[model samples]
Target: MKKITLLSLLAAFVISCADKSQAPGAAPVPLLPVATVTNENTITDSEYPASIQGKVDVEIRPQVSGNLDRVLVDEGAYVSKGQTLFKINERPFREQLNNALASLHGAEAALINAQLEVDKLTPLVQNKVVSDYQLKLAKSSYRIAASNIEQSKAMVASAKINLGYTNVTAPVSGYIGRLPKKQGSLVSASDMEPLTTLSDVHEVVAYFSLSETDFINFKSHYAGKTIGDKINHLPPVSLILADNNAYPQKGKIDMVDGQFDKTTGAITLRATFPNANGTLRSGNTGKIRLGINHDNAILVPQSATVEMQDKIFVFTLNKENKVSKMPITVIGKSGVNYLISEGVKSGDQIVLSGIDKLQEGQLIQPEKSAPKVAQIINKK
Candidate 1:
């Protein structure tokens, strides 16, 4: 009985040893999608909040103080240069002009009388009918009368200018704004509020700002010796209206603020767009879309990257299919891919999935596939 039990135990031990030796050599290395990094040309858009203004924005105000007698143009009406926009009470101005004319006539009559006296005295003095002192005094009186006539003429001209001011005219071709003062309302040159505002919308300007860092990046992308040169070389930009619709006409960057705002630490830029149809107006809000082109740029899918400790990393495979976690410097984003400036270069293989389960130096079965190159043109 003891010998049979020993045989059974020996058979069990042999089976256990065979099972241990046959165990799966090791869990098959995880298989994950792999993509090759490639260099391609693409354009990415960056948007900045902007404020729109007309090419010529002017405040319409009264030059002369008087009661508003008529408002000729309605609010939001288009006007041309020299068109009459409003009429102040002209009766008072006309009366002042008449008074000036009467004074001028009176002065003219006095000048004629003075001239007659000077003529009479000149002959008398030459004939010895009066002393030379009397002639000199008459000549002085004539000079004073002539001076008075000149002064009266100046007064008449001044009155005419004031009368002309009664009819307020448009200074430029533009659209009229609100008419705060109605007919019969008193308006003056010193009034706190302007009568209205005029905006020449034949073309519109959009003003946007960029932070200090963004400005530096923007400068690096373009090739120019000066800001003005950069502006001239810059490609046309697009305007996105408040409703998120792109403005039909593209705009050009024409101006850059001379200095950064001390408070905001940002620099302002101006882009001008043609508004032949008057689609854009003053006080309109929008965004400026600036496109940056990249040539031979290395792009990587965002999904293949993992962010740790505020740094982005990717799993790159070596010749032996061993993956090593590598850090990449991202310059910008295009659709679902990232624009890589540093790190892995062209022909580099990167693991596309299951990155969370990957260790620093893990073996991966790279299921080779084409990398996703984002849409060539992307807007943000």
Candidate 2:
């Protein structure tokens, strides 16, 4: 009876195993949202940290030593070229000028006397009353007097220049910076600091740098053998101001450094922008936006990528609808997309959703998807 009961229990366990195998819930294929890769022209934009400066920058310093008698223009004023911005005490310069003039007048009187002596002796020598040697000595005296008058004239011209220096004027049209010296402050040519600075902001320049590798890559994209030709072919760039707003006018790359900086291993680049509204100034910080046009390029949504062990990968669906984790090389980043340089080609489909649940060689149900990738990338 015990043997019969044991046989019946064994039969029941076998039936249970058979039932489980015949059931419909073995392993489920996960349904995933996917995006189809397409070939298209994409203009990828990149931004670099930049410092802005006015086209012209001038330091306002005293050309001659003097007390600042009057501040003709206040700080932060818009000054035109040759406009008097500061007035030094003219009394001292005027007195020096008068002294120079007096010396010149005395030299001129001496010259007149010398000329009178020469004129008086010329006829006497002609008539043989005075010897030719004596007449020659009188003419020589007159020439010496004329030379003295020339030296005095030079002194007068120098004094005039010095007097003109008392009235400090703007060297170029621009906005004035801080004024270190007020009306009572004394300034001189040898002072370590400048009185003020002027910046011409009719146009502005943005300076930026690129790493050696990046510079090489940057030059490779443009069509040219020489750097000048490359620069000429370069398209216009854009500037983002400090306030995070795009400037109204587009700028061009005006200059490129001939060599890389030894210390930084980076090359400098400059772009110029028109400042019609006087918004940009020297010492302003901003960003320079450079663009590259890719023809028939393959782009992948960043959401489709998975990072593991310091590498990037995406799950590509095969003809059988089975997923295989494929590696990809990202050369650049755009708004929510990776500018794929290697690993994946055009027309490849990649999983865009349910990446966490994905596994190597996993079978999945793919759904056509257009994710909010750009929206997500921009927010980040």
The best candidate by TM-score is 2
Could you tell me the lDDT of residue 112 within candidate 1?
90
How many clashes does the backbone of model 1 have? 0
Candidate 2 lDDT over residue span 121-183, tens digit each: 989988999799988898898898899899989988998999999989998999999988888
lDDT of 2: 0.86
Name model 2 segments beyond 4 Å from true: 1-31, 243-245, 368-380
User: Model 1 RMSD to the real structure?
Assistant: 4.7
**313-346: candidate 1 lDDT, tens digit per residue:** 9999999989999999998876677889998998
Task: Give each model a TM-score.
Answer: 0.81, 0.87
Error of 1 at 33 (Å): 5.7
lDDT of all predictions: 0.89, 0.86
Clashes of each: 0, 0
